[model samples]
Target: MSAADADTVLFIPGLWIHSDSWAPWAALYEKAGYTAIVEGWPGQAATPAETRRNPAPLDGVGLEAITEHYARLILQLPAVPVVIGHSFGGVVAQKLLARGLASRAVAVDPGPIKGVTKLPFAQIRSALPVVKSKKNRSTTVALTRKQFRFGFGNALPKSESDALFSRWAIPGPGRPLFEATEAKKTDKSPAQIDTRLADRGPLLIIGGGKDHTVPEVVTRQEFELYDTPAITDYKVFADRGHSLVFDSNWKQIADYTLSWVAAHRVNA
Candidate 1:
């Protein structure tokens, strides 16, 4: 397909990072005749270094605001695009699907949604750096390299994990984390998802086996929550972790995702 005829793919980054995190995957998709748009959450700094230097801009941002931002972006798109998101972004992608905003969607190691009930000890420990401090709800919170290693890069070598943390880590708003955990507390929570919608489109949930933040069990439960089994699928990278998109083997995951999209191409 030529660039004009190619499908548009919107790559949504997760917490603590900017859209630049998707540069590699975006380049790969463009090379394969797709238009890739990498969108950062609202108030994200242009670069990780800048974000680390000043994170106050992200404070007080919540799931509702972030979701609405993406929803508006999708509504303005020239065509219904394929949405791919990781971590928190994954949950937002599902919310977009619920709104009938995507032609297809892929969520990688997505954060907990409304219907997922299992909360593993590892997951709790991983989020403790933020959740343990209520003050973080109004202030930006950044994870230590140690915390990142434990939560996102556990499957990688220490040196690599450290490097990735230094390069991509930044402060993130804490309200979204609180909202995700407290989703069940309210009937009209922003984290709520209607996976059974007939127009929800094709959905793929990808899990990282070694992920402490959102383990395989969590992603599996998310997949099972969708009543339309015919349009929902799940895949797991047995040796990966929450940082699967930034891991050394990220290309493998990217290629697999590309293949999945091609298989479910709207006009294929």
Candidate 2:
């Protein structure tokens, strides 16, 4: 099919990362014969600077709203789109797949979901500032450069880490981290997903071995949580960190996702 008549790929950005950062990935996907779209969360500003200046709208935005936003968008699409999401977006990608919205999904370094029990120290430290108090659940938070370095850019040099932060970082809601951290204990948690959907689209969960924010162990646990007969796969980048999505070599991850989607969606 020509690119215009081919499938659409919806790209979802994770927390603290601007939606516009997905532009490069969108171009890459379009070149591979797919229509690409990247959207921001509910109440999110169009640009990083605008959102940084007035983040009030994003303070209380949580997974439910974000999920609904994408679901509504998916319904209006020309066809069931292939969804690829990173970090919290990863969580949403799986949720969308469970809800029968996407034809196939690739979740890279996704946030911890309801059934994940293991929380590494680095994950805890990265999230403690926001998940420590109940009030933070309704507030917006921005990561410090140092925190970003540790959680996302640990595997990259300081100069590139700083550049990525300056270019793509933005304030985001804290509810996801809070809800995910306490997901197992919360009733009707937004982080919950139906892992037993045997007829749903295929899923590929990617992990970053050097990811401090969402450790590779957590990604494996999430992969293990699926109890269905549906296809579920997991892959790990042994030397990469959470910043794999937007770092200098982000195309590596994007290309892998493109290949996976092509292989799996053929039977989806």
Q: Against the unseen true structure, what C-alpha lDDT does each candidate score?
A: 0.86, 0.89
lDDT of 2 by residue, 1-91 (tens): 1112128999999999998988989999999889998999997899998989998999888999999999999888767788989999999
Off by over 4 Å in 1: 1-6
Which tens-of-lDDT digit does each residue in 183-206 have in candidate 1?
888788888888777755788999
Clash count per candidate: 0, 0
Could you report the Cα RMSD, in angstroms, for every candidate shown?
2.6, 2.6
The superposed Cα distance between candidate 2 and the true structure at residue 156, in angstroms, equals: 0.6
How much does candidate 2 score in TM-score?
A: 0.96
